[model samples]
Target: MKRISLFLLVIASLFSTKTVFSQLILGPDTLCIGNELQLSTTVTNASTYYWGFCSAYLKNLPAGSSIAAGTGLAGPSSIAMAKDGNHYFVYVVNATAPRNVIRYEFGTSLSNVPLATDLGNFAGSIPVNPKGFELVNTGGNWYGFLTGGATSITSDIIRFDFGNSLSNTPTIVDLGGLVLNPQDLYVFKEANNWYALTNNGFSGNLIRLEFGNSLTNTTPNVVDLGNPGSLSDPSGMWPVFDGTDWHLFLVNRGTDRLTRLDFGTSLLNPAVDNDLGNPSGLLNQPRDISVIRDCGSYYGYITNENSNTMTLLTFNGAVTALPIASDLGNFAGFNGPRYLTRFLRDKDNVFAYTTNNADNSISRLEYNTCSNAAPPISTLQTPPPVTYATPGLYNVYFASDEGLPTMQVDCKLIRVLPHPIIEVNNDTLICQGDTILLVANGPGLFSNLWDPVYNTIAPYDTTSIFIYPKEDYRYNVHLEFTQGGGCAYDTSVFVRVSRITADAGEDRL
Candidate 1:
């Protein structure tokens, strides 16, 4: 009987080893929209190797470096970026005097200067300061929500309807009052219900607002989530869903420690605080944090107020108490870094920014995501590139080691971007020796190249150019957006020159 049991255990061990060793690797998980994926796998020479993209697995944390984001920002506290079908808008709260919200609009890509527009103060003017802010886009419309902090008395949360543009006078609604000062607020949607969660710094209670199915719901179901975990001065928090359950990791400014809470599946339910004692890098008052999940791991960047530094904490899963902390050190401090935000433009392109409240400047961290990349391709020959007309998230999948029961499989999500349409003049008849302007105009910025250089005007490379043509010319223009991921388009124009004939009917006499 002992020999039989040992044989079974040995066989089970071998199978486990096979499952781990044959596990396929298809990575650089995050991709810029419209970029062609050069996919291939390591298990080569198999009868067949198949692959695609869908839900994926990630292993390690990516590395990043910090710098200050440009100038012209004043007392900016919280920042959030939302993508409309055609463009991206960044909203920042000017938490100081003459308090108002600043919008930075970028088109197609984040390569150029963004247009900054100040959308007046909260309704009834600015009384109390603006707290945690978030922007969410549902259907085709954009919505901006700002939390009001308590000064001498309780304040109400406000919502703004941006329609399609954040520039117009927003339709604002005061969402009622709370007893304590509100801290960091987060807004998200699940199923048909839209929800916003905000915790008060003074009351130590987490508040939730349910907007139901409508983005414009004025009367939200407000609930005071009395602090469940002895959470003192609750401030910065980040949530993650690991296939089955939803977990929240937040910092308690009052206790100078870290706490984890299990919210079962939905964040709507009350979260049971799971305390994770103090780690070394938490520093003095950990104010705000942002979390990113890929390959089954969570990477969170936290801002410590008193020490004026940033710390990088990682976890194996959402509910784990063992958070590995690494103090990224201070970024030329004394400039109290208050809140932090991150934008993963794509794999190989990641950036995080911290709003320095003291000096009124923003510090940016650029991460290197290109290390240990092994993208798997099923078909030995890479498939011809695909062009997605509209922009959104898409599923990709791949399979390998065909004809075997233990074939390897992997999947991930891919984003598609909109096409950059080149606007120019149509076929036209021009008088001989006359000059005409050729223009390719659009929003954002682009690189334009005009072919048939002969007879073309000076300033050959630009969005709009003048042409002094002596002959009928067919000009083809190739355009590429300053937006990365190889987003490009081409179009052409023909110019007909009408010349007056000064010759006899027959050959010259």
Candidate 2:
């Protein structure tokens, strides 16, 4: 009995230790898609652990089915997945203390199966400390950015070319002089050029590196957008070329405002377009900007780091002053959203992937059926249907046929009219007995009339009318339309029969 009790006590202690070790501590997680999504979670607490990919499509994943399983005696700082035919190859940072080492795991099926072969230390001397990393695909190969370390003056961009087995030697691109204590690095390709942006605040010293046949010069060209009398530090800058001109969406650190930088005639010396000012009150600490191109225009999605919101910018020649922040999924639940990328899933569907740094999770949002909505119908309504007396800007009372409501409403059997626009440009002046051509500019209404009440027919087919007024009179040209709702009316003012000297008197003078 005494021996049995001692054995039970030892078993109890072991169980307690194992339970404590099983808790998962996740550091920043990232998700990417190809054949299947590669979900990476960084573990910090335990050295030996098991990890597998359970489909996010599965609300409650079963215990056995996962892409790959792995065990390591060292904590993993990062994990990456590679496509091997229909299967995926899983790699992890296995150890760190004695020397940085990486281990490999492979599986035929997405079930939680152990690694078939133990490929030891794929890369030598894994950097001691890593800040942030982004996985990139180049020429059918995968690479990673390992940033931040003690005694490491710079960040290293490491390339992993997976052939029969993962490459043992990774080409390291040093960013020592470029970034100061870099926190994160992202690689984006635009116009056959690949550019990288770092979190290091180096004022006008943002590194602009180009990659092609070989990694070009590390001495990146720097362009400083003169601070617009604001002490706001630059957060992130996204450069986009709109076929004709290059524009930069700059996130300001001090005021949480997004400033547009027009690269003028040169790539450098960007001028601020004040007309396309920051939409009054929206983002707080905007971090990154991603653009989605449409037919001829571009829409930008700016990630607000502090508020955890995204502001959408509709790019015209100059960006519209008013921007709409589509209330995507709430950020309160998932905070510290650092960056966002938009992908068009199908013909009429779009998805936005946001990287939440604090929650160690990525959120995917889908917007569907955007094109099936009703087209905007504009209607103009005027009181008394007379004409203006003077040529000046006037506020015409108007409302869309849809409604005055802020949100979009669909399929209501209501005949709503759009607000009327001022008719200042429609004003006309003509001399006595002198013919003047009057043209109808507004939509829908065609034929014109000379009488003030639109009762008398004028000699015009809604295109242009020859008017000859004999005396000083205020004439109103009535626009006539014959559609479903017959004879819609729009009036324009004309100052006819103006005082003028005769041609014979002018020749005598």
Best by lDDT: 1
- Give the poorly placed runs of model 1, Cα more than 4 Å off: 1-72, 111-113, 122-127, 151-154, 165-169, 317-321, 331-334, 369-509
Each candidate's lDDT (Cα)? 0.59, 0.39
- Measured by TM-score, the strongest candidate is 1
Candidate 2 regions with alpha-carbon error over 4 angstroms: 1-177, 181-204, 210-213, 216-231, 264-278, 320-333, 370-509
The true-structure Cα RMSD of candidate 1 reads 21.9
- TM-score for every candidate vs. truth? 0.60, 0.42
Tell me how candidate 2 scores on lDDT.
0.39
* lDDT by residue (tens digit), candidate 1, 313-399: 777654364878887777434267776654433213344556677877656555432211234222552333433333655444444
Model 2, poorest ten-residue lDDT window?
Answer: 1-10
